[model samples]
Target: MSFIQTLNDAWSRTQSLLCVGLDPEPAKFPAALNGRPDAIFEFCKTIVDATAPYASSFKPQIAYFAAHRAEDQLEALIAHIHEKHAGIPVILDAKRGDIGSTAEQYAKEAFERYKADAVTVNPYMGFDSIEPYLAHEGKGVIVLCRTSNAGGSDLQFLSTSDGKPLYQVVAQLAAQKWNDNGQLGLVVGATFPKEIETVRGIVGDMPLLIPGIGAQGGDVEATVRAGRTANGAGMLINSSRAIIYAGKGDDYAQAAAEAAKKTRDTINQYR
Candidate 1:
């Protein structure tokens, strides 16, 4: 299935919009697994299994693994998701942006090497930087629009000649010009619910990979009201630290499950 179809199917099957983000940090790991080899994989795998029932998708931030020299663990983690969770898509949160061969190599890294179902990318480099990923048919190329960080406004809010913010222009391009394959999505921060509403209006029913809900304090009700489609199914509401690190002991996985379930239920209430 295409990335969008698989995402929509997962949404229907799981009846949840919650996207479990895996951003493992060894310093934050529980005592039982803190110094263990391949602990990154072990920690994320446990969370995946515990929260699979409530998740519509999983997003693994690549920097977390790479920073710890755990790239192989990241690969294993994604493969485990494909094997155990089946239809649940994995989005590689790499935010890669380059042109020509460099972009192609990055695309290969995300799809061929990591086997990510989709990837978050920086569109600051323009359309050519994105075309290489589109070349990989059925894979999702999610462009960063209004990111969650406050520093994002430094560039994303700049005015264009048409009196529109840069992020809005990016949304317009992704929705109209750049979405030829119907596999594109936008990363609109849940922190900016009003911007999300503006982007949703521009993009129609395109899928949105929303971050900032849990640890970043994005409001669930406002996010849903602004981002959901007519069917209440166009957003992937992500919560990472609040869910994965809910417990610091041996029962961390169970605690994570509880947090995920609560988040899923809270999101469903608005839908």
Candidate 2:
């Protein structure tokens, strides 16, 4: 199946729009798992296994793995999710962008090397930087539109000649221009519901990978109210620390599962 179909099937099967983030921070790991060479992988595997029942997808932020030089572990984690969870889509949140050959290599790393079902891409360099990922046929190319970080507005919210914000323009380009294979999606932060709504208006039913909930304090009710598509299935609300680090004990996985379940239920409540 294609990325969109896989994601939709997972959403239907799990009855969730929640996407648990596998961002394993070494210092924040459970006491027993901390300082171990395999801590990152072990922690991520546990989170995936625990949240699989409640999650429509799992997003592993690549920087965490790269920082620890644990790319092999990331590969193992993605493979494990595919083997065990079946339909749950794994999005490698790499946010990569570059010119021509470099972009091609990045696409290869995301889809071939790590085998991520989808990936987050930075579009700052324009369409050429994004096209290589789009050429990967069934894999998803989620272009960064409106990000969740505090400094995102520095570029994303700038007005163009047509008076539309740069993010809206990105949404327009993603929906109207780049989505040739029905695999394009947008990254709209849940932290800004109004921005989410604006992008939704431009993109219609295109998938939105929304982050900044839980730890970043994005309002769940506002997110659901603003980001939900006409079919009530476009948004993937993500939570990292709040879910994965819910506990620092041996029962951390269980606590993470509970957190995932609660996040899923809370999102569904508003849907």
Candidate 3:
């Protein structure tokens, strides 16, 4: 199935707008899964088994896995998740972009090696850099338009020569200029409610991967109001530490499920 079809299935089957971030910080794992050789993968599998039914998708930031030369372990974790949850779409949240060839290699690593349904890309390197990622059939290419970090304003909020913010330009380019395969999306941080609405305008009906909903102090109601498409869904609200680390002991899975359900219910309030 194609990327859009997989995501559509996930959203419909799970009845959720929640995208759980399986970023298992080493220190946050349960003591039983912390010091083991494959603790990262074990922690990830436990989360997937517990919350896959509640979450629409799972995203694992590459940096978290790249730490300590754990790429092999991360790949194993991805395979295990795909094996167990055959229908659950996984988004590899590696914000990568560079020259054409290098971008192609990155695409191969994320798509062929890890079998990710979608990979986030940084568009600052121009469309040529993004084109290589598009070559992967049925794979989503999410561009970073506006981020939630405090330093994001240093470039994102600045007005371009045409009097539009840089993020607006990125959204227009990605949505209007490059969205053809039904696999393109924008990463619009929920921290900026007004900016999220503005991005919705530029992106018409495109999917949005929204972070910062939990633990980052983003307003749930405002983000839903601003982020959802006309169909009342299209935004992926991600919560990493808040959900995965909800409990540190043996009841971690239950706590994580509760956290996921709570986030889903809260988002539904505004949906």
In order, what is each prediction's RMSD in angstroms?
A: 0.6, 0.9, 1.1
Candidate 3 has which clashing residue pairs, if any?
none
Against the true structure, what is each candidate's TM-score?
A: 0.99, 0.98, 0.97
Cα displacement (angstroms), candidate 3, residue 17, comes to: 0.8
Q: Tell how far residue 5 is off in model 1, in angstroms.
A: 0.4
What do the candidate models score in CA lDDT, each in turn?
0.96, 0.91, 0.88
Question: Clashes per prediction?
Answer: 0, 0, 0
Q: Model 3 residue 250 lDDT? A: 85
In order of TM-score, best first, we have 1, 2, 3
**Candidate 1: where is the Cα deviation over 4 Å?**
none
Best by lDDT: 1
Better of 1 and 2 by lDDT: 1
lDDT of 2 by residue, 83-108 (tens): 99988889999999999789999999
Cα deviation of 192, candidate 1, in Å: 0.8
Candidate with more favorable, higher TM-score: 1 or 2: 1
Candidate 2: list runs displaced more than 4 Å.
none
**After superposition, candidate 3 runs with Cα above 4 Å error:** none
Q: Provide the lowest-lDDT 10-residue window in model 3.
A: 26-35
